[model samples]
Target chain A: MIQNVTLVGAGNVAWHLGAALEDAGLVVDVVYSRNYSNAKALAERLYDAVPTDSLDFSESKSELFILMVSDNVVQQVAEEMTLPSSGAIVVHTSGAVPLEALANAGLYVGVFYPLQTFSKGKKVDFSKISICIDSKSERILDMLAEMAYKLSKKVYHLNSEERRKLHVAAVFACNFTNHMMTIAQEVMESNGMHFEMLEPLVRETVDKAFAIGPDKSQTGPAIRGDSKTIGKHLEELDGKARYQEIYKLVSESIAGIEKE
Target chain B: MIQNVTLVGAGNVAWHLGAALEDAGLVVDVVYSRNYSNAKALAERLYDAVPTDSLDFSESKSELFILMVSDNVVQQVAEEMTLPSSGAIVVHTSGAVPLEALANAGLYVGVFYPLQTFSKGKKVDFSKISICIDSKSERILDMLAEMAYKLSKKVYHLNSEERRKLHVAAVFACNFTNHMMTIAQEVMESNGMHFEMLEPLVRETVDKAFAIGPDKSQTGPAIRGDSKTIGKHLEELDGKARYQEIYKLVSESIAGIEKE
Candidate 1:
């Protein structure tokens, strides 16, 4: 079992994951960032955690090193980290990155990605989130499974390819979903209405989608193929060609028409 | 004030709205549908509502004729209804149709469009939904406002133009949102994974969007301009041109590239 961990970055993921691990009874031994203040700020959140600017963990007694850094730097940071080679486990909290990124950095390298979006200062219920863990060795994987089970109710052993697919799906489900909301807000504000008025509808739609399946919960002119209403909506778009294009293409897709 | 109502359809909106009106102390006098069975099915839910397949309302003592029919039939239903002259108010519960559609049927015509996507057997809290009411005359508008207030807290006097925009926005925020979920679901299921694992991330994404505004809630490779991740994602969608196209266009839009 991994009893202690060193957070290798001070990002939103690092902050949240670090706190959740601490709450799960694991000792967060050190927090490190290129910027010392950021490391110090996050380190201050945990009990008796030290903050460091360097990647050298030669002096610390941490059994695990968790790379909460950006995807671009996951390999770089892993390569730079001072590992003891035998007793330590190195893991990254990235969905886009593969487990092999840290292969040369430590003897036992793995992935500890939580499939959720985190923002600075915002609290997340880690207990409800899905944690996807992957590793080469069975022992390390078992250790990860045990550690993850402590922080969340849902834990799965997903490989690099599966994690990449999940990451892409997340991009659509979360990022594109938010962009759609932004479009709705722009449409409302442009027409002298407040976006807040649509909150109940938005909330209800989401609830209904999950309650029934998403494929079965679909409604509107698009799915119904009410072309007249669709035409009128497109006409209403008038000058905003961008929104009109999206509205048209998405509507077509919903109606099961592609290659047009 | 409108005390009794003649519900002009037996669809999902009519089913939910009829219940809400009765709960708000208004008498649902009649439930009508072209199919007599559908009318009876919904009518059975009310305390004393009569189910009818007839368009004539001359026999009923309903003061408000609420047309909850399909958008294409709103004007046709209004014309077919055997409305009583002068005292009776005619209104259609549609976001697309104008109040003028019911003008020839009665002296008072308006809209009582609740901005919501209702599903049968799925209960919604009416008080949280927005009711967009509009009429040409002040007295009729006030009557609709009074009736709406009893049903919901958020009431807005939106004209037909504004209501159209609101409807389009609903299409994006609700329908398009659900479609995105469907895309994510398909992605997961086809990749040897269950969509339920994504529920936590989906829920958090929505919560964040509403807590902080949607404009400020966007996070992904698209917004970050992470070309490597974007290329990897596009490559993952290989051979699925429809999804690849969407991924490209939406990513470009998020990156603020409208024309190119």
Candidate 2:
């Protein structure tokens, strides 16, 4: 049962997680960021959270310290931070980084990776988000799981490798899907069509994909093996080599999946 | 003020469109399908629609004839169908086939394309769908627009070429996005992870993509040019050459997009 917490980094994930934690009756003791103003802004939103640029935690007695910084800086920040040897659990909110990245931080380390995309000004409902947690000790895992359950109903005890694989899957699902949408928007905008016209279709595609597994719900010229339509689409994207390449590759992949 | 209509074909599109037309108070006078049972099943759901296997519309007196057949057979059906020469408007509900495909139908021809992904047994709300209409004559366009407005608030007067372009974009936005989701699901399933864990992320990805244009909202290792993480992901997809290829190409494309 973690009662008090300290947040490191004041970016999108940190801001949202900090707010959710505070709302769940946890006291946020401090928020540390290289950009002091960012830390100050985020800290202002929580109860009795002091914003500071310092890495020293000797003066505070928070039960948990969460490193919510970027992937490149997590290990560095973890190495530099000084925490109590035995009492507080240190965790980083990253899907890509392994628990070993914080192993040398001289504290009981764990991962509290929330598997969801965060936007700065948007308020996220944590209940719908999956929180992936892993720790070296059973006691620490239980404590982290309890804390995670307070914020999210969907909590998983994923190890480092599983969490990393999940992150890769997320890249394909969320990141690649968004890129496909960008290509669609470009195609519409180039032809003097409004992007909003594709919104309903977009929503239906996602809904159908989830309802009946994406493989089974696959449609269009590619899966139909209609080379004529594929040719026409390629012709439509003649000058844009990048777009053509992506279309050809993905379409062929879909065709391959269908063949299997 | 188009009211009485006859539908040709009884697939997913025909099923949904026929229901929406009937619910909007339009008389579906007849339905024709090569598969008599399909036509009969659909026609039974509508108001006073007679099911027939014959292409001949000589016995029917509907004001409008809508060809809701597949793209390969749209022209063939149009060339064979017999309709009232002067008053009845002949149209096809196709995004890929042009207005010219209906030119030889020997009537006032037009397009009544509803830009949406239709699945069998799924009842879609017509109000949110966009209906794209086009015709050679002002009178026919006005009548089609009026009928379309009955089913959808979002109606666009796109010409054949523009509609075809929109269809291509739909392939990317809807079909390709769904394929990316398929890959994600495959990754998760292979790793013994439940697909539902990805649902919220998928929803948020679409929401963010729409809120801020997908190109601007794009995030991930690829856009960030984090070569180390990209390398790790590529290595992770080792044996699956197809997945590896797609991941590399899309990541490179995203990196390229970021450069520009």
Summing lDDT over every window of 10 consecutive residues in candidate 2 chain A, give the lowest-scoring window: A81-90
lDDT per residue for candidate 2 within A1-260, as digits (tens), equals 89989999999888899999988889999999999999999999888999999998986789899999989889999999988655678899998898999988865899999999888756788988999999989999999999999998999999999998899999999999999999999999999998889999999888888888888888888998988889888988889898899899999999999788
Query: For each model, chain A TM-score?
Result: 0.94, 0.97
lDDT of candidate 1 over B175-224, digit per residue (tens): 98888888888889899998888888888888887888787778888888
Off by over 4 Å in 2: none
Per-residue lDDT for B1-260 in model 2, tens only? 78899999998888999988989999999988988998899889887999999987876779999898878889999898877644688899888888998878866899999988888856788899989999989999999999999999999999988998998899999989999999999989999998789998889888888887888888889998888888888887879999999999999999998888
User: What's the DockQ for every one of the candidates?
Assistant: 0.74, 0.80
Q: Which pairs clash inside model 2?
A: none
Q: Each model's TM-score?
A: 0.95, 0.96
* Cα shift from native, residue B26, model 2 (Å): 1.5
Q: Evaluate candidate 2 by giving its C-alpha RMSD to the native, one decimal.
A: 1.6
Return the top candidate by lDDT: 2
